[model samples]
Target: MYHRDRSPCSALAVSRSVERPRAAVLLLHGGHEYGTSAPGAWNLPAARMVPFERAVRRATKEHDVLIGRVRYRCRGWNGGRADAAHDAERALHELARVAGDVPTVLVGHSMGARAALRAAGGAHVRGVVGLAPWCPPEDSVRHLDGRHVVLLHGDRDRVTDPKASADFLARARAAGADASFVEMRGSGHAMLRRSAAWHELTTSAVTGLLGLTPLSSPFTGEGRLLSGA
Candidate 1:
């Protein structure tokens, strides 16, 4: 069953199949670079993530995995305040409270992906899947050591630079992370063009990072870029 819980920093819509989940996945959605207003139920960014939530639920139906969709209290990163990252941190704390120290994966898109990557240093986080991430040069990779990080960016994305993500991947690797980058051809920042491929790659990365299953052949190598045509 699904339930919604509101925290000081964000809200979480959680669905769990078992009483005690063995693992968890948290979904974070995109937003602008600067906005402080709270996102309502129908907010396009939050709504856009619903399908990915369903995809994760279906992919992990047989397993004792908890799926959570996080809604940030604010609409943007809001400069160095990083409102969404703080919200994501709080959500991770809540997940820890409900599921113990179980391994967790964070899946985020665009600005949300930036938040996920920032919050990935949390104790429960085992991996991160960033779809069309908005990675800036100053983003840190120091916290990513020993963690699995997968960045999927479309070459056609004009909003978030795919090249920036590649640079971040390189930094993550240098910092001892198991990081890789996937370039989606003919796709854009919203991820609507090759949506199926995005979903497939995300599910594959999540399950694989959690050790529930082996990563698909296409995503096996380090720093490899797969065609998402």
Candidate 2:
């Protein structure tokens, strides 16, 4: 069943399959580069991630995996303040309170991906799935040691630099993290061009990171290329 959990700066749409979850996945939605306004329920970026929430729920229906979609407090990254990442960290803390230290994975898109990557240093975070992430040059990979990181970026994206994500992956691997990158050809920043492909890859990545299943072909190898169309 699904329920809502509220915090000072964020909320969670949680789907719990068991009383105490064996694992958990938190979904973060896309947003702008700079905006301080609060995001309402009907916001387009939040709405865009609804399908992913459903896909993950279905993929882990038989397992005791707790799924949560985080509603950020603001609509943008807001420079170095990283408000969204703080909210994600809060959500993770809340999840820990409800689920008790079960392994957790974060799945984020666009700006949300940046937040997830920044928050992946949390003790409970076991892995991260970044979709068309916005990885700036200043982003660091040192904290990702021993964690699993998978980045999926569309080569055609104009909103975020795919090359930056590639560079981040290179640094992540060199830093001792089990990281991989998937170049999604023909897809763009919005991930609407090949929606199904994005969904499939996301599901596979989540399940694989949680050890419920093996990763799909694209993520089985380092820096694999996949057709997003």
Candidate 3:
């Protein structure tokens, strides 16, 4: 069953399955407002999370998927990746408290990616997935050691630049993380639903990262190594 609630901090959207429960995917929205609940108020610039939601639902046909569209300060001095990560960590803990101890996968876009990485620090998170995540702080590299990370970026993305995500992924791999990169050719930063390219790539990456074999996107071999910025 999927549930939506308004918390003192931010609004919550969760979907869980009673049958075929595996792990959980925690979706975090990109930077926008601090803590406001209004329609389309927190729509991130380059991070299209709507289709990601649908993709997760389809992929988790046999598992539970939870999405948390948080509203934290993402503007002004207090509104940055660091603050986003701090608040996101709190929100994940709250969700975990309600859902019990289940394996978690963190999915973030843009600034949320930084937050997800920070939250994964010392937590029981299974993996971290960043979609067009910006350059993280140098100190943040230590937190990703021995963690599973999947970084996705569009080759035509101009907002965050594909090379930025590639560089982060490279550093993540160097830090001993099981990190991989996927380049979506011809796709822009704003992911269009029903987009064959976007759908295929996301479906493959999400499923593969979660240890599922997708018949639609069969694996032949690892893709190309995206060069650093």
Candidate 4:
């Protein structure tokens, strides 16, 4: 059974069976604006993008993972907004209450990545997976401390320059945050949709960051290239 709820700031949570013990994950979609190319544009009721929901389900099978795809108000981190960090804070609290102390992972894609860094606070989040994070505000960069963060970016990405992620890496490291950046070769913004290498690289990076075993070949395309034996 799937449970869905409309929280403040237009955020929402959809999950399947939350009674069991599992790792909790919060997926923040990149759609701060209502029109144009928002990161979460493909996140409709039906779409063939990266199976975030499926990925969440797979993670749940091993460790009680509850994925919450979040959406916030406005285009930037509105700390003043009642639904900004406070909304995520409430969600994290509720997730911990339900999952106990299984550790939480905040997975954000594109603009969602930007928000995740801002929303990452308190002592509950164990790690963060930022897929092509955009430039964060100056304040968010300075406050990142005591969190294991993993940044994944496609070398050929055109939406949010990979260099931006590189910059984020530098700032994250300077702030004493455990962070690393993995480059997906020959992949575009939608790395997961490209080929096996992208999927393997991403899954491996995230797995290593989260201390989990790498899953085999999650990609289903035919343009993958394998180099070096």
Residue range 1-229, candidate 3, lDDT tens digits: 4345555455344544343345567776676435433335545542467777677778667655444554554431134435677667776777666566666778777766767777776465777777766653353577778677777777777766677777776777777776777776666656552266555555566666666654223222233364221
Deviation from native of the Cα of residue 104 in model 2, angstroms: 0.8
The model with the greatest TM-score is: 1
Q: Which stretches of candidate 3 lie over 4 Å from their true place?
A: 1-3, 10-12, 15-21, 32-47, 73-81, 137-139, 212-229
Q: What is the lDDT of candidate 4?
A: 0.58
Per-prediction TM-score to the true structure, in the order listed: 0.94, 0.92, 0.77, 0.71
Residue pairs in candidate 3 whose N, alpha carbon or C atoms collide under 3 angstroms: 34-72, 34-73, 85-115
Q: Choose 3 or 4, whichever is better by TM-score.
A: 3
Error of 1 at 34 (Å): 0.4
Better of 1 and 2 by TM-score: 1
Q: What value of lDDT does candidate 2 attain over all alpha carbons?
A: 0.85
Per-model C-alpha lDDT, please? 0.85, 0.85, 0.62, 0.58
Cα lDDT tens digits for candidate 2, 1-229: 4345655544565755467689999999999988899886588887778888889989999899988877688898999889888888888888887788899999999999999999899998999999999999898889999888999989899989999998888888888778888888888888888889889889999999898998666666654434443
Higher lDDT: candidate 1 or 2? Answer: 1
Distance (Å) between predicted and true CA of 101, model 1?
0.8
C-alpha lDDT (0 to 100) for residue 175 of candidate 3: 78
Off by over 4 Å in 1: 1-3, 6-10, 225-229
Task: Choose 3 or 4, whichever is better by lDDT.
Answer: 3
Of candidates 4 and 1, the better by TM-score: 1
lDDT of 1 by residue, 1-229 (tens): 4344655544566755458789999999999999998876688887777778878888898899988877688899999999989989988988887778999999999999999999999998999999899999998999999888998998899999999998998999899888888889999888898789888888888898888999876657776655543
